[model samples]
Target: MKQISTILFSTVFFPLLQPVWDKEPFNISNISKPDAPFFLEDAGIKEQGAYFRQLPDPRIKSRIALSLLKTNNEKAVEILENMLRDEKNDNVISDLFICMYRLRDKAKITYSERIKKYMEHQDQLIRGYAAALYFIKTSDAATILTMLEKENSLFVQELLWNELASKPKSCNQEDLKKFLQSKDSIRRAGAVRVLALASKEPDSVPKLKKAAEDELPVRIALAKALKEMPDAGNELIAKLAEDKSSIVRALVASCAVSDKRLKTLVKLSGDKDWEVRRAACETLGGSKSPEAISALLARMNDNYEPVRTAAEDALVKINPGEDTIKKLTEFVKSDAHRDAAIRVLGMLGAKNSALDILNVLNGKAEDETVRRAVEALGRLECKSAADAIASKSSSKNPAVRKAVAFTIGRLGVASTFKTLELLTKDKDASVVLEAINAMGLIADKSFNKRLNEIVKDVKPSTSSDMRAYACWAVSRINAPTDGMMEEMKKLFLKKIIPMEGEKTYDADYARAAAIMALVEMGGKKNEPSMKAAKSAISFFHENPFKTKDEDSITLKEYMRQIQAVMNGTEIKPELVPTVKPELVTGKVQ
Candidate 1:
């Protein structure tokens, strides 16, 4: 019974031990090298090497064959070669032959011969992999692909098609030419990529143009391909700008931006899709064509910020002259415009007339009025009002002082910057803090060192404001820092706002300043803060103070400031739609 058990165990387990035995006694140094057709009878090699061998089930055989190829073992090839004789396993053998083709370090004659057998394989996968191997492993120009004519599977055909398209030296140009005009879109599309890559054959452009009319993806791919050729497909890319697909239109716009194709892209600016409009704006900006300015300006009313911003940006890029400046200047004053006007004017660099326009800011002086004026002046470098602005610095009014300091800095001149420095030393802490902020705005490269010096000298009482403004100025003048953003929000949320405080102009100014700061920051982070600003705006608009004049509220200046920040419009709560003339005449609400 023991002997029978031993024999049974040996039969199953002896093959597994063969590799160990072979390693011990099979020293190749003294023995002659084994010839081909060697078989690894070891159970481990038999199981693993079967991957390269042809088997009845090609799927299982292919998976295993891939593993054997990875081992790069010489005996695996012998096992694969023997499997090729079985007709049922021809698919597996074809795959193994392709693997053998890849064994060569170079695309030499040996590799091409091994890959050539796949052209006769009945299976499309075998034929596809074979074609891939031939194109990738060998550079023989005469291997004009003849198998693509017989390919049946769309996927395998795509692979073969790409091989022909990409490998110019080895591609069958005549076959590819015929395929470019094939009734099948896929084949024709593949041919386009192949031919366009090979040569911008003028004759091929007509086929691509025809294909683009019916196919969207191929049109875009062809557009991109044509963009690279010398005037290669400029007309085609321009024509694609009118494509029904917004994605295609956007790509064409992008291409237009790169190629300075303003004429065609301008027509796309009115695309029904906002995305296309935005892309058109971006393209116009790059084109820098004067004709695009009006189109971009028209798009400024787009509901989307990206579109509006792009349009405004494009206007500045194309025609940043008197017309664009006038529109921006008027927009900064328009209640209907978005807060982006501040950026528009800043980009305009029209700071010279910043203070001059303050005289026109007499429209119910809301904090928005003062804030936008301040930002515009800061952008324009209107530093002439240093003394007048400084005198109001300590007028026992935080709003007036904040506005004055903001304006002084917005003027962007070092002369007014000194007044800000003096205000930082005022007995009133907020006054002193606002002064430090003014220094930040006048980020005249000449005062960078001085600003740094004063930033360090800020007292502990207002270091938070100083640090906040210091970082803000640095962001405005240099690069943005995470600290600046957080501190700005903190100051706006806590110190720079009056959520439900007394109706003092200072309280109003503080709230308005907070709104302006948040708007200037310009991102989703300000969503909650903007909601607060809206509330404050509504609060003031509903309750009017007693005024000597009947035509407008007594606090026109304050109203104007608020209105400016609220985009020059007030959202008066319906409860008190308009300030009654009798209310400001001392009659109770």
Candidate 2:
């Protein structure tokens, strides 16, 4: 049990530090999305016309959403539509779909086959805009159901169901009730959300009772729908909390709490399934009741790290400032949960706990516990702990050495680069890599000549974590000489494939780093290699194979600007596009 928990704890990435170049580690719930359609504030005909003239290509419709606000949207519709017909960039096409959708009323368009075609586009963002435009213009329930049959993205699904509820004349309640019994699961689940959304109290409540016996997805949908309806009553939430599937109980555990519901949540906090207990902890993070604190603090020693983390977040929220500090301070001094408490105090930026952790570092704690203390001090940004942390660099355990390297870099002082440079030559490969990467965070140019040699030594496309971060680290050192650009053109531009045992996510990030370096080095005029590299990146942004974060395409638009610059055509920042706010998908899962 202890071994399993230790491995699980190592895998956890806290909602912690964010480097400007990196997006949060990818999770479906927090995927980076395309920019919403932007309308420059107070845009008028002159502003639109003036801004329009400056675009490198007025046909790239994404850049001028606000600039086009004053142009007769009717005439503008024809121009934007023609431009998108041959467009290839998904982000660009997404911007086009939104631009055309914005002009729908002025163009007097119908819910025609063309709109349906756009709805079926491969891009999630594009499909969402098409669905929204469809929802606004069509009054046919069959049309809504047809789209629903083919779509399953929670973000898009939530949009369709909620719109179905508002447009009473568009779809009758009978159509949704019939779908509840449909053989297709998406239809069955959609029906639950739609019915619950349009719930007419006592009458609608009876229609949903049979859903308890439906398939798991449908039941899960039913539970989520109730979350939005606070007046739906704790009895309903309490019933779902007793669900046979831990997933259903977890979803129900998140519903807004009432006095009666709090008792149910507290009971669930001790649930047999750790996930159910975790969900209960997360849901009750907002409560101030003493019971909530007691249940959460008890979870601090949980076998699963995430459960303990969820509890830590709950305690911090309920007892912020000195109250939380006082609770956690005692937790660190105790023999129980020593590693977790030490790291969490750092995560919470407990300045008062800094000396306590430093004391642990100097003690005869276990190696793993010593490692945690180093990481905790790093998170706390304890510059004063520098000498003390560096003293652990020669520990026989490589893991301890790795943590020492990480914390030293997080200290972010130029003086520490000499220390990091020494670790870069460590016997252990991982320690060396961590040291090299850590040096990137510090703003010193003195190491570039040697760091550039490391970039030169890499075998292209191997996708070594060191290779990925070496590319990342090199960009920060700012050596944009022509000689380096020549090497990047010959090497870094090759498709950086994941090494046999390496993660694809790191390889994908390596691709971003190489392009960022080249963009700074300045692209050669009309270089086919550069253009091909740009196309590859656009697809990465459009359809990341296994890459999780949207930031995998962070350099897409900026690269576009660089390409334009290489061609001697300058573009304005105002023309960069974003998705329309109302058009962004939401609220499904």
Candidate 3:
């Protein structure tokens, strides 16, 4: 530890205390040492001259070296040049190259020779570093090109090729030609990228065609360049749409629709890869051409969800009216298309078809399909399904029961309070949570006894949600007992408000509802919980329903209402009728 400390402090203090060019240690070699803490102070103050003179420890040397270059330190150029001579730390050398490359005119011509020597250093790190500096300086392109012939690291070669590709049009044309002629396929692919990006000359077209047909990366680069070129990119896209590489084919197909390449794009809708097929569907959706819509409709049943989703999304974009709706209805009757159709119907506001979804939930579909149908029915606000949804409150599947609870809550049916109250003892934390939410919607005094019992004796896993819902239920009952409000305050401070960053994988919506309940229960007496509720309400104001779950969104609004009560506000008049104001008024109706 003693030796470690000595090494740690040595580099930090050495350069400050010594002459700028001193080759020996400041303590013994006649070099003057400057004050140490002043250097740290100057670095913090962003004084480039003082910070550049500070010696960075070899361990975190690159950080300090990069800092000097970022500050544009001219004096540090000599220091970086000196570090370049030793080849032990390649990362340090890479940082030094970045430093000198930025301060190019300050770098001596002899530094160029050292860079050339580094190109043959056996390590790809050093060679790639040297290639980058050579390209950035627009010097020694021929030498770097020759070194590319012997380089083997794929990542390093890729970087070197990109640097070469970014060079000015007038520089290194001959070297790029030799790369295109190289027997190595990757090097040849790299050459294709350079010509396509650097020149933009017509002479490179045949080479791009050959490269795009042979390699995936080269095809991607060519596809991007073609997309940027006026009209020409569309033509190349049509050709590459048939390429064997799915990724390349997909990228080109994505670009094709924007450029009106529908004929070729329609064929790509049947591409072997789902990703390519989806891209084709997306492009067809954007087309104004009638052919495009026809192609997308055929792909609506493409066996892949992304492809199906893209097709459905495109159909909505085209506005095909009743024909599209009829197709979706027919699609929903098939087992494979049923789930996707339900999602589309929800997005389409097909509220009248909620019975169809309810039937699917109660009938032959699998558990997963039933779950989607239940969620869709909830989103459609199917009031007529109140009895059907309430019956599923005892579903063996927790997710189904949770969904039913939310649906029943949304319908705002007072008579179903007994059914929801029965779910308070459900073993699934999620189901009990939704039941507690449903109780707040109904606000019946008859249900309060069971709610209070469950809230008092619920499992630790659900104590927070139970306490919160109980608080909300207690508020609705308007039946505050000796310790009810105080217990509500304790629940807020200990369970909801105080436990920041606690890892609870249980539903956040349930947690938020619990917080809302505390706010409503605490009302005038629970000041601290009220203050915390204000903060929690403010936190969620911007994006209350991040989960995209309707139940979560409703809970967020409930929390906001609780905050409003704390602030002495009234419920919005429009929502008063639908939300059933008696649930909040706390008076016997």
Best by TM-score: 3
Which regions in candidate 3 have their CA more than 4 angstroms from the true location? 1-120, 133-152, 163-178, 197-204, 215-217, 224-232, 282-296, 304-306, 309-320, 415-425, 430-458, 463-485, 494-589
Q: Score candidate 2 by lDDT.
A: 0.64
Per-residue alpha-carbon lDDT of model 3 for 170-248, expressed as tens digits?
Answer: 3476667677777677787777666766655533367666665665666776765554444445556778887878877
Q: Is candidate 1 or candidate 3 better by TM-score?
A: 3
Estimate the TM-score for candidate 1: 0.44
Instruction: Compute each candidate's TM-score over C-alphas.
Output: 0.44, 0.52, 0.61
Ranking by lDDT: 2, 3, 1
**Which candidate would rank higher by lDDT, 1 or 3?**
3
Displacement of residue 358 (Cα, Å) in model 1 is: 5.2
Per-model root-mean-square deviation over C-alphas: 26.9, 16.2, 17.6
Local error of candidate 3 at residue 406 (angstroms): 4.0
Estimate, for each residue in 1-589, the C-alpha lDDT of model 2 and write its tens digit. Answer: 0122111101222121123245311222232323433332222333443444344453433565533543432545545555555556677677767776667666634434566677777787788777767666665567777777668686777667666756644666777787776786767777877677667551246667777668888888788777777666466677778889998898877777666678888888888889988888897887888777777777888888778778877876775557656777788787776776776687778877888899989888889888989999998988898888988887999999899889887897665667777787677877877777676766366766556565555444222455545555655665544555444443434432435755223333344455555543334332543554465455544663434644433334445544554455655442223322221112312
**What's each prediction's clash count?**
32, 9, 3
The digit string of per-residue lDDT tens for model 1 on 17-136 reads 112212221111212112212122334345555433323455766666555444323444445444454435665666665665555332222345555775666777666666666666
Residue-pair clash count for candidate 1: 32
Candidate achieving the largest lDDT: 2
lDDT computed for candidate 3:
0.60
